[model samples]
Target chain A: MKILLCTDGSSYTARALDLGVRVARKAASAVDILVVAKRDREEKARQMAEKAAADLETAGIPVAIHRRSGQMTEEVVLQAQAASYDLVIIGGRERRGVMRLLLGSPALRVTEHVPASVLVVKGQARDLKQVLVCSSGGPTSERTVRFAGRLARALGASVILLHVMSQLPLTKSAVLDDLEASAEELIRRGSPEGVHLGRMLDLLATEGRTGHAVIRRGLVRDEILAESREGQYDLIVIGAHITPGLNARLVEDLSAAILLTANRPVLVVR
Target chain B: MRRRQGKRLNWRKPGLALSGFLLFTLALGLMKGGAGGLTPLLRNHLEVTNAADSMGFGWLMAYLVLSGSPVAAAAVALLSASVLSYLQAFTMIAGSRLGACLVVLLIGCIYILRGHEHWTALTAGILSLLLTGSIQLAALPMGLLILGRGWLDGLSIPALEGLAAGINWGLEPLIGPLAAFLPGWALFVAGVGLVTLSFRLFDRALPQMRLERTDLGQIPRLVYRPEVMFLMGLAITLLTMSVSISVGILVPLSARGYMRRENIIPYILGANISTLADTLIAAALLGDPRAVTVVVTHIVCAAIISLLLILLAYRPYERAISNALAWIARRRNNFALFLGVIFVIPVVLILL
Candidate 1:
């Protein structure tokens, strides 16, 4: 497997480099460290890339240094697309209060716009001890579970797969009486949440990564945030998007909320 | 030779039923006014001089009948017949609404007995009570103030003039023969039966929801936006013309895991306000401008209170109700306490 790691010469960027090195060394994957900078800061960007590459090389892992100039998110996105990389790891830029509201951090933007999976490394935890993954059993859940498993296998980490259900479910009258609805048996079933957790556990087992499953009933965002804080897990993984439908829009997107509020690193896998 | 079978709209199925429903409603209205031979006893014993007492009296009356519309009709009849003052009549309507909320909860009790958990079985019914209680309670003071000021009283009933005349003219022929054949008390009993039949007809005309277990199971877990639920509640109540029916629809949905905690309150609020349409008809039938004023006060008060809560304090209100519900659902003893409280409140009010 090949991985693309993006840095902007920031503290979070350094953490991303650490994660990439550790992951690549365990999985025997090649790492390409890319430093995205403006025209004036190209020299600074290249130096950061060279340092990341040297660090990976010392671990006896294959590595390359790439330097680019332009918008940080756009350059990283372009480079990942241009190369055949299995995963893209980036660092979250922390800003306070109004600055965050007006100017979104680069890492959030990359996760929002990227078609491929992007991990926004948040904390400085290096041992890769624990990971928490949240799922709603949407279409993207299988991919999210599979990717989290791969990460666990590479880092020798334990996984916690969580699925949050509403304590009080809401009912809406259907437009057509489903009783009058005519179709095969396949069309009759609903998207049960347990189906997602089961698939995730099965996928993780295939990768030889063992994990415990948590079924929480409450507000999705609140339960996820509370669990992450209480567990103090090293990393949090969630789907970047749900299977888009009118039903999907009813609740606030759990992924977006967790990524913003989670103190630990959040990997918004697509 | 082939025999030809003739058909014309098959009035027996839909049309005859519709006409019978209308006739039943007409009969029920006449029966409502005449049936109150017991009205004098109730008024004197209840001592309902003001809004508070009237609300208490109306609530008890609705509980006795197990229906809001009949109590609302009784309120209007009392107002028209000089049995209750305008203030007493208006407050009685409010009380009837509060009492009407218990009907769904009573149905929920049946579900609970049949082996469903108290949480799923009673959530819809309890939500109906809570939303109705909150909005109606909020509107009580506003309704009193509005009626006291005579601000809305000046609104004309010109549009209803034609409707009032047509209803009386059509029902007058049927009333004479029925009155001569039936005693006064019999008229009220027959009216209650006909009213029940009319509601049954309405229920029959509605397209079947007929949700399978799969759909029923899914809806309980799904949640909708407050505004969406509010509109849905209003629309369904308008179609069914009864809050009990709308709430009963939620029971199966809740049991199957289709209801959300947040979706129910707003929907109940919508259904509560819309359910007053029956009283509106009752007010028109009375043909007293003051009767119209009383009903309007009920509507305006409920609307103001519900709108305010939906816009401003919905989250806190939702949380408070939900937390309480969760507390009850988590324990068997608490559920019994809740049932006792709901059952006894009206009984205590009736006695006092």
Candidate 2:
């Protein structure tokens, strides 16, 4: 796995870089740090990239730093498109007033336009144990679940697969029975036929998927975040309708609700 | 700096040319009306049954269709006023009334810039008209020549006859009472006033209306893919056809309104007359009659209205007529918006 770590020299970015290096070290993947800057200052941008590369190298994580200049969103998107980076990591900052009013922060624009998966590290909340994955009946949800399961397995953590069904006259018996059957089928069909269903199945399989089968009926973003907090998940994995670029800001993506409100790491898969 | 100065100079020349053109067109119109003894000729012409002289109505209809679009219509009117000064003299009376709205728009722009330097505001106003007018002039002749005289001849004759028939059906009952009580000019003035008032109200309100500019700069993230345009186009076509058919059925009922069937002829004729404002303004500046005639005939067609209605109906629900056009042109071409504006705005303005 090749991970792309995006930083802006902010403290939050530094934390994201540290987390990215750790993840890369564990996954045995090479780490590429992309520093996107405005076009007018090339020397400062290059110096920043060199310093970041040196810092990452000291951590024993193989690092390649790329310095890009232009409108941050376009530069990041262009690089992401050219490189076969499996994941993109970026830092999020709380925006307000005129900064928020004009062009939304670069991270938001990148999230809106990029095609690659994004991981937005918020602040100091680094240790990810309990993982939450919002599942729809679609293929994106299935891919998200499988990805979350792999990460959870690596961390020796528990996985929560949340399916928020907004439609209801929720008779508990019928709803529970339907959920059980769908969860069993998802596990059975989502994995290989010959592979043991026992490994994929949750401890509460008779009830539904592992962790919790949350059926809170509301907006998709609100329900996902509510479940994340209530269920005490450290990391939330959501399917994105868009990809993230180097300078892509968080506010642009609706899915960035997880990063903005949840105070947890958001792993967005496209 | 040098390039900027050159551009400024280039801009200034067009501005001067445009002001001169507008003044010339207005002067020519006044002169034609004066030369012909406006009251006698207008009254005589109104009373005469030109049913046998199909050419006169045909010419009117031809001019109407050609002037349906702003660029073409204005040029044609200007050309007619300059070369066929005799015919244009009468045409300008009606054309000027309709074209006066654009003059108002230009004037409004001036007022908007009132706080700025006088010379700068004047320069900007002239520059805007010149740039816009040049584009209209260039586009008009091409549109007319492509459509050709034969096709226009057929369209105008039928459209004029249809309009006349529609009006006669509507006005036959009221004509006697109206003739006895109201003068012709009274009705004309009332109609013109209503149009002008509606336009004023609309202009005042439109600025407050908000429209979203959906950024489709990234192709991969587009919610509605390229295939959606075809689907949307088909849906719009079906809806427009249905509405048109329904309107046709209700024409008799609609005749009861103040805008009787005969009004349809003038309504359509007024659209032709109004559309000529832009082109006429352009031609007056260029002093080109052939180009103006060609443009005017093409724009005045019934097809222009049909096309405009079709486009307006298809404009997306969330979008204004302008934004929907921008979205539709996202992948195809930028010129689509300009073409759409030429077709859509005049019809909307005239019908409203």
Cα-based TM-score, every candidate: 0.76, 0.36
Model 2 TM-score, all chains together:
0.36
State how far residue B292 of model 1 sits from its true place (Å): 4.9
Most accurate candidate by DockQ: 1
After aligning candidate 2 to the native by TM-score, how far in Å is the CA of B237 from where it should be?
23
Clashing pairs in 1: A169-B259, A169-B260, A170-B259, A170-B260, A171-B259, B219-B258, B220-B257, B220-B258, B220-B259, B221-B257
Best model number under lDDT: 1
Count the clashes in each prediction. 10, 34
Error of 2 at A9 (Å): 1.6
**Interface Cα RMSD in Å, per prediction:** 8.0, 27.9
The residue ranges of model 2 lying beyond 4 angstroms of the native Cα positions read A37-61, A70-72, A97-101, A169-213, A242-261, B1-352
Residue range A1-270, candidate 1, lDDT tens digits: 677887776666777777766666776468888887766666666777787678778877788778777777888888877787777888747776679879876677777666677777776655678989887666677888888898888788999988765533223222112222222211233324445555677789998898877765545566788888888888889887543565555543557667777777788887
